[model samples]
Target: MGETSKRKRKRNVSLTPEDITKVFEKSMERASADIAKLIEAITGGDAMTRLGVELEGMGLDRMQVIRVAKYFGNKPNQLHIHIWNGLNDSYKPDFVKAILEE
Candidate 1:
């Protein structure tokens, strides 16, 4: 019997921080200002599930899907990361800066 090896498939897609930010923003776009505020109101609830359900419904690409999954796994922490990409420049200083302070 001849030995044979199968090569593992690798994704050609390489997502830069910029690309991640773009995808996260795209996923966020599916959310409205009302929803964002609503998330704030329900802090201890299943915010990640809510966000993930919303992002999952948005039909994000594979990378974005994975990103959202990871973020959802750690809801409150990743909330900053998600909001950093999702929110406007004005709000970025708050959310993005929070991520750094941790």
Candidate 2:
């Protein structure tokens, strides 16, 4: 028998601050003029469940997902290394848009 080994996959997708900002803006596109509604809409909503299967695939717990939302909603200026390192590009916009949706 021959010995074989599987390689570990690494996501090397590095997002610049601008890229993060772009994604954030896209997620909040549905926000209207009302600040309260905008915050409510973005931070907590049915959007999280929108990613159904993708949630399990990404291994993101509920709080982490909420944190992602809050991070985008409130602190778009900061570099959120945790979510950035944990999720790749694919799991990003979809997750954010899920909550951002009306």
lDDT of each: 0.56, 0.55
Q: Against the true structure, what is each candidate's TM-score?
A: 0.28, 0.23
What TM-score does structure 2 among the candidates reach?
A: 0.23
- Considering summed lDDT, which 10 consecutive residues are worst modelled in model 1? 1-10
Cα lDDT of model 2 by residue, 40-85, tens digit = 4554433334434444456777876666556544554333333543
Q: lDDT (0-100) at residue 5 of candidate 2?
A: 27
lDDT digits (tens) for residues 17-63 of candidate 1? 99999989887887776687776565534545555555555566666
Q: Any runs in candidate 2 off by more than 4 Å, and if so which?
A: 1-57, 76-102
Judged by lDDT against the true structure, how good is candidate 2? Answer: 0.55
Q: Pick the candidate with the highest TM-score.
A: 1
What residue pairs are clashing in model 2? Answer: 47-98, 47-99
